[model samples]
Each structure stands twice: as structure tokens, then as C-alpha cells.
Target: MSKKAYPYVLIMPSVLFLLAFFVYPFLQVFAQAFTHSEGGLTIAHFETIFYDFNFLPSLKNTLLLALVVVPAQLCLAIGMALMISKMEKGRDTVLYVWTIPLGISDLAAGIIWLGLLDQNGFINSFLFHVGIIDEAQSWLNYQNPWAIFAAIVFAEIWRATAILLVILVSGIGLIPKEYYEAAEIFGANAWVRLWKVTLPLLRPSLQTALILRTLLAFEVFAVVMILGGSNMPVLMGEAYNWAFSYRDAGAAAAYAVVILVLSLLFTLFYLRVLRVPKEAQI
Candidate 1:
């Protein structure tokens, strides 16, 4: 093959895989979302979802969860990454321990939290034994929306912060030691150096991690289902309900499209806010 053609050939498998798995399914969903079951294109599916009682609450919950969880995770991950970076010993062991949650599936994480938060579970058992409460409390019930939301948030943060930690740690490592040395020589302290030197240089990695984590946050499902159940409606849960429980493919597709649009808009926002100049990339 010609040199120009060889590059395309090298990427052919990936392209074909994306076309078959991603592009094809996306087109199918888009068509189902807009087209009437019997014939030509229509907006009925969108209208149905827009009019659904659950739609607004689900949308709000999804956005609220993402907003709350992503920032908390980002802060925690950055702090952990900095601690690991400064360690003189056992860094690998510490990192391995911290990332243990990464090996646990989302459902498993949710279940583990559920066991702790359940009325009859460890927290209540401990509280009762310690005379903190006269009896077990229904922490995960529909009446305890705050507790339910907090449980899901904590579970998600525990399970996913490792993703950002790993990315930030790698980005910090890529930074040349000379930069630190120069900053130190100029009398820049740790905090000053972090803001002036580290974070600015780490923009690319921040952009990447934020985009990935935000997208995953928007699509959160298994954990929410396991922890909050129908008490906490989210976009993904509503989509699943429409598709499977209600057997309305078009409505499900519309929910999926809403999620896709949100993801795309946030991605563009990150790209704009965190855009690194070509000259600044390490």
C-alpha cells in the first residue's frame, strides 16, 4: 500500500468496529426516536417523553448527581494524587490500595454500600449496640431522600475517583522535574507552584478526565438502581423503564438522545474551557 494509504489501513479495524458497534446502533436509535412505528417521521416520541411525569425529576436528578459527584471526585482525586506524588516510600502499595475500588464493579459497590446503609445492616447494628439509637432506622427508604442521595453519591465517589486519580498522577509524572526545580529556585512555595506550574501544565489531562468522568456520571444507572431504586429517578433509569417496563422503544430512544446531547454539550464546554494552546503541550 502507498504510505498515505497505509495509515488508513492501520486504523481500518478500529473504524470498522466503531461503524458496526457505535455508528450503526446510534443511527438505529435516532431513527426510532423520530420515526413513527407505522410509517414516516414524527415527533410523538419526544412529545411523550417531554410530557412524562418522571422526565423532569429524572433530568434534575441526573444533572444534580453529576454536578455534585464530579467536583467532589475531582478534588479528592487531586489530593490523593498529590499525596502519592510526595511520598518517599510505599507509593506503589498506597496507590494499589486506593485503586482497589476500581476492581469492584458498580453494582458490587452499590450492593456493598446498601449492606452498610440498610436498616438492619452494620451501621444500624453498630448504632444500636452503642446506644446511639433505640432501633434501626430506614435510611434507604423513599421517605429518606437525603440519605438515599448521599448513599449513591458516596458510592459513586468511592468507586470512580480512582479513574481521575490515575489520570492526574500520570499527568503529574509527565511534567519535567526541571519545572519544579526552576520554580523552587525562584522561591515559589508548594501552593504557588501547584497553581502556577502544575495545574496549568495539567490542563490536557484535566480536560480528558473531566470529559470521561462527566460522561460516565451522566449515564449512571446500576449504582442508582441498587442504592435508591425507584426512589431516585435518573435519566438512565427512566430510559430503562420506558424501554423494558413500558415497552416503548421510541420513548426510550428519546431519553437516550437527551443523554447523548447532554454529554455532547458538556464535552464541548470542557473543550472550550480547557483548550490548551499547541505550544503549551508537553
Candidate 2:
């Protein structure tokens, strides 16, 4: 087929899929957000989702979790990638062990953590045997924000780090042996070689890891609900409550749109920071 014919043929499936699955639902949600039985073409749904104090708290909580988790994941992933790349044996075993959590369901992980943090849970049982405490403390129900934050951090890190690890490893593989060999011959120690060669070479991979992990952290749902409970605020959980519990689809759609916009903004900000040059000099 000609180029013009090929473009339409290549896009036809995607266009059909979008129309069938995406466009119609988006239109419905947009209509609901904009219209009311009494008030026509009003922004009340968005106003409620944004201006409401409850929503702000949820939004704030989400941002806080993402900010804390994303950077930590990237750092840990970098270390893991470097270590795995340098390993002469059992590298596959270590990679499998680390990524095993990726296959574990978020809800299952939450339930597992609940058991660990519960009153009569294994941790408490062991500590009691060791005479560490007279009774089991409420690790999950602690009034301190750090308690919930810690659980969120743990869950996010456990599940998401593998994605970064895989991406980083792929990037590391593309860096030719000659580059690292050259660095070694220049009297560059392991740390120096990592800084000058590995880190620079991994910039594109770093950007991808950051963007994906950051967005997922922002919208963390099942684990948060299971570990932290609905008493605490997180954007997606709050949106679920609005849509299902309260039967407010408009508000839920508004919240979803807000999250989508925030994700796009973050991507733009990261691209600006990376500012990848045309030449593959890195």
C-alpha cells in the first residue's frame, strides 16, 4: 500500500478501539460533570471536588506519598541495577527475588502487612517472646501520620521498585563494555566509574523510571485502602468513595481528570529537566 493508505490502515484499529472504549466513556463523564438536572453547563462538580476541604486533604496526602516514594524507589533501583550489572553469578536469582513482589497482589500484600502489624501478629508474638514489649502496639492505628506513611512507603517500594529495576537494567545493557573498560583504564575506581559513566548513560532510563513510578505512586489505591484504611486520605480512595459509596460519578470523574492533568504536568516537568540533546554524547 502507499504511504497515505498505510497511515489510515495502521491507525484504523487504534481509532476503532479509542472510539469503542475511550471516547464514549469520556464523553459521558464530561457530560455528567458539566450538566445537572436543574443547573445546565455548570462547573459545580469540579468545584466540589477541588474546593472541598476533604478533597484537598486527599490530594495533599497523595502528593506527599508520591514525593516520598518515587525518589526512594529510583535510588534503590539504581543501586539494584548497578549491583546486578556487575554481578558475575546468581544475578538472575537476585533479580527474581526482588521482582517476586511485583506478582503479589496489592490487596494480598496489604492483608499480609495487616497480619504483621496486628495485635497478635507474628512481629508482636516474636517481640513478646524476646521480652521487647508487654503487649502488642497498634502499628496501623497509631495516631502519628508516620505510621500510615511508613506502611504506604513500604508497600509502594516493595511493589514498584522492580519496574524501575527492569528498565534500568535494560538501559545499562545498552552501554557498551568499551565505555566501562575505558573508565576502568583511566584509573577510575568503581564509584568514580559509576558517577561519570553509568549515571550519565542512564539518564533517559532514569527519566522513564521517574515518570512511570511517580504517576503510579500518585494513584496508589488497593494497598493504601488495605493498609491505611479509608480514615486516612489518598486521592484515588477518596474518588472511589465519592463514586461508589456516595453515588457521585460526576465528582469522581472530576477527580480523575485532576489526576490526569497532574500526571501530564509532571511528565512535562521531567522532560524539561532531562532536556535530552540530539547527540547521544551521554
Q: Each candidate's TM vs. the true structure?
A: 0.96, 0.90
Model 1, residue 123: C-alpha shift (Å)? 1.1
Instruction: Estimate candidate 1's RMSD in Å.
Output: 1.3
Distance (Å) between predicted and true CA of 182, model 2?
1.7
* Model 1 residue 4 lDDT score: 86
**Candidate 1 wrongly placed segments (more than 4 Å):** none
lDDT of 1 at 196: 91
Error of 2 at 202 (Å): 0.9
The top-ranked prediction according to lDDT is 1
Residue range 1-282, candidate 2, lDDT tens digits: 888798899899999999989998877776777776476887888988887777877888899889888889888999999899989999999999999998998888877877777677888898988999998777777475688779778877888799999999989988898998999998999899889898888889888988888888778888889778865688889789889998888888877777878898999898888656869655
Cα displacement (Å) at residue 252, model 1: 0.3
Clashing pairs in 2: none
Candidate 2 residue runs with Cα over 4 Å from true position? 2-31, 37-39
Superposition-based RMSD of candidate 2 using all C-alpha atoms, in angstroms:
2.4
Each prediction's Cα RMSD?
Answer: 1.3, 2.4
lDDT of 1 by residue, 178-259 (tens): 9999999999999999899999998998999999999999999999999999999999999999999999999999999999
